[model samples]
Target chain A: MKLLYFAWVRERVGHPEEEATPPAGVETVADLVDWLRARGPEYAYAFAPGAAIRAAVDKRHAKPEASIAGAREVAFFPPMTGG
Target chain B: MAVRLQREPFDAGAEAARLTQGREEVGAVVTFTGLCRRGADSGAPLTALTLECYPEMAEQELARIEAEARARWPLADALVIHRHGRIRPGEPIVFVATLSAHRAAAFEAAQFLMDYLKTSAPFWKQEETEEGTSWVAAKAVDDDAARRWDEG
Candidate 1:
């Protein structure tokens, strides 16, 4: 799956997008975030539990409990402030 | 229904004219244009605001919201145009217009579009200030504004 980051999350993660294959047990967005957090310092910082993160699965806004089974794209960012 | 996401600046007058042109049945046209401001809340000099979005998702979300506006109201047509990339202070950020047979519908639909777009759209904004650049946090007030429509 392709993971995209935006705004400060992108700055912290150090990349706009990347392809990653999470371990088989990771079936939901929250689990994926936990896995990503363990990968590196930047990922840890960006996906920290306390961080005000919002996500989209395949371009649609998603909650942490949302499944990622058939998703090809997952994006993470801060809450939108656009008008 | 028209939803356009582009990097080029648009003329609000021209866009509204295009949407309302040749529509004799339309009695009211309500238009709202959002502009980038020079300062955020810090009172520091501002230079620009960088807008980022999930390309395809942004258009889809805007269209979905516009469709909802059309469904809830008796609108002749609805239009949404949003600009991405770096925008300077005073540059137009977005434009929304609704055409309807009554002023109430036009006004309500336009406000509805703005309120929903402010919260649900997949776009992020970062303000560039003299002190330094910072991402503008989403306001709870915007979510509350959108929630009002849900109550009905």
Candidate 2:
């Protein structure tokens, strides 16, 4: 699957997009986030200690509980307020 | 329909004229202009807004949003103009216009385009404030707005 980052998340992750294969047990979106946070310092910094992160699955905004089984792309970013 | 991703501020009247040209089925026009804000929720003094995007991805995503709007409404024309680079307060940030056979389609199409853009577009904005420059975060309200569209 392709992972896209935006805003500070992209800055922390150090790239705009990358193709990746999630590890075992990373079934849901929340689980995948936990796995991503454990990847490295960049992932940890991007996820941060306690910041509100928003996500989208294939360009559609996704909730934390949303599934990731069929998702070909996933995006993580901070909350946006642009009109 | 024209979807433009540009760095220069757009002229609304000119853009509207461009979209309406050679089209006779368009009976109603709805337009929305988004401008840069001077402050965030904390009321910090803001100087400018710097927008960034993934060049290839931004264009593809915007095209998807416009296509979805057209599928959902009977629009004769749709125009989405988004400006990148640094913009000061009161400067235009984005413009969305929908031309349809009736007011209802135009109105709904405009709203739908804006909602989808808020959630799906890859544009990122950083606010240069007196306190310090900060990257803007996606709001829960925007997620809620986009979610509602799925239910319809």
For model 1, what is the alpha-carbon lDDT of residue B104?
Answer: 98
Worst 10 residues of 1 chain B by lDDT: B37-46
Which ranges in model 1 have alpha carbons more than 4 Å from their true place?
Answer: none
Question: What are the clashing pairs of model 2?
Answer: A78-B138, A79-B137, A79-B138, A79-B139, A80-B137, A80-B138, A80-B139
Q: Could you estimate the TM-score for every candidate?
A: 0.98, 0.79
User: How many Å off is the CA of B118 in candidate 2?
Assistant: 0.9
Best by DockQ: 1
Q: What share of the true interface contacts does each candidate keep?
A: 0.84, 0.36
* Residue clash pairs of candidate 1: none
Expressed as tens digits, the lDDT of each residue in A1-83 for candidate 2 is: 99998788888899988999998778887888898999999898888768778788876767888989878999888766455
lDDT of each: 0.93, 0.83
